[model samples]
Target: MTTTFADLTTMRVGGPIGRLYVPTTIPEAVDLLQRVAATADPLLVMGGGSNLVVGDVGWDGTVIKMATSEFDIDGELLTAAAGVEWDRVVAAAVDAGLAGLEALSGIPGLVGGTPVQNVGAFGTVTSDVLHSLSVYDRQTGQVERWTPDRCGFGSHRQSVFKHSDRWVVLEVTYRLRRGGQSGPIEYAELASRLGIAPGGTAAPSDVREAVLALRRGRAMVLDPDDHDTWSVGSFFINPVLPEVPDSARGCPRYPDVKGVKLTAAWLIERAGFPRGYGTEWGDGTVALSSRHTLAVTNRGGATTSEIMKFAAHIRAGVEARFGIRLNPECDLVNCSF
Candidate 1:
């Protein structure tokens, strides 16, 4: 029986798929992908099913869900199947005294999905610790081990799975540090909350605790009871635009590949889209999160169309004011404006 796409995504909104295969093993998953690719029928590879927004009309193709959620650690390295939850991996790493991922404690979604978007939080991004991956290259129908360089990880992005959907992340290997602490706290707000200097280190578990607490405060942590967490996490990646000097641009900038990443939240706020925008009495079907401007939440019964309209309003408003276009972080399917 096919599972409705709504049952699989965090958004809990989508139509039905022609077929949905929950493969329990890597081989089965690979074979299914190969067969689908050979047929040239459209297919989607899903993980914990976070970070997706499928239209109400649903998908017309097959969806292969990776359900191989095994995770293990040998020495300081960690290996996890694509289906493993990403935040749970962080918790495990912290409990094991592994340091590198502590600051990324509350990120949602699956392990395999981490590399897909270079999932990150606080000051820690996944690319910082990823060492290798076992991937099925759909282009050649071959399974191979790939290094971080081959993955083309970037600011909230990676080449391994972006745009092409040509690789099914079977397993991922992370080179985590042992018995040390989190990498330097690069986020000023986090450091201030922890009472440490910027770029300072904290005990791995402490960092995890602090990060989780901070996330909870911001309503970034997933809590089914909280409608704020019902939406995709951070709807937009901070827009990294061409570097204009502070003198030339008249605002702040953070380092990035081409230039600097401007916080989309900052731009949205500056552009006059405040938190809880478009809501009446602070309650609307589709609302900007009260705690964070970057997140668009479903107040209740909000459809993909409503969310898209709100998002489009914000995008146009921001672009008109800041002269920079914002790109959505979630995989927007079947809706175009």
Candidate 2:
């Protein structure tokens, strides 16, 4: 039987896939990739599928799911294969008395997706802890180790492999500190939750719980029972603009190398689109997550078109009201704004 993309993705949308290939071992993965690369058919490399929005037409290519779940921790070094659960990696690091990854707790997706996006939360990013990666180079058909500097990580959600099909991550190695304490808290809300001043520290386990709690409140954590959690964690990447418009004087701003990062959720709220926008307005198939302004959720039986329409509606609203356009953080598959 052919499996649908809905069966594989978190958003639970998409049509039937042409073919699905899951490689459980390293040799098998490399060989499969090489063979696919030599073919004229298109290919889609899928991880946790947490960051995807697929259309009703679905993909017309070979869908390769990274299924190798293997990991090893030696002293302060942790090695994880592409398919290992990302949260599981954080938990293991904390359990082993490591500190670097505790702030990233409760993030969805598999381990390999981290470096591709330079995944970050709270104050730390994957690049901060990553030592190296075992990548299968599609161009040369060779497997080699790549260092952090080679990944081209900078600014919000980017890397050499982020949108490129030339490099496929097979495994990742992270360098962590051998302390039981969490890294210095940088997020004000998280710091307040831990009852610590900004820049203060907490135990790793404590940090994990606190982060998870915060995510749960925003419906960022996955929960099958909650309609609010039925969307991608955040629909928009916080827009980094050169300057804040006079109309958006009250909008929150953060400094970034790219310029000024505007708070997307704040813009959405200020634009008159509050949380649960669709439930109260249009067809109930799609709506803003009840807990998070940045989330565009599927209420029930919502099609990918509904999600895109709703997202475009939000983007257009934000632009008209604030003079800033929001970009989606989720990976759109066969779907466009």
Worst 10 residues of 2 by lDDT: 5-14
**Model 2 C-alpha lDDT versus the unseen true structure:** 0.88
Q: Runs in model 1 with CA error above 4 Å?
A: 155-158, 245-250, 281-283
Q: Encode model 2's per-residue lDDT on 266-333: one tens digit a residue.
A: 99998999888888656788889989988888887878888898899889998898778789988888
User: Runs in model 2 with CA error above 4 Å?
Assistant: none
In candidate 1, what are the lDDT values of residues 137-229, reduced to their tens digit? 888989999888988776546465776777789999999988976788979988888889999988988888888899998888888888778
Colliding pairs, model 2: none
User: Global lDDT of each model?
Assistant: 0.81, 0.88
Where is the poorest 10-residue window by lDDT in model 1? Answer: 244-253
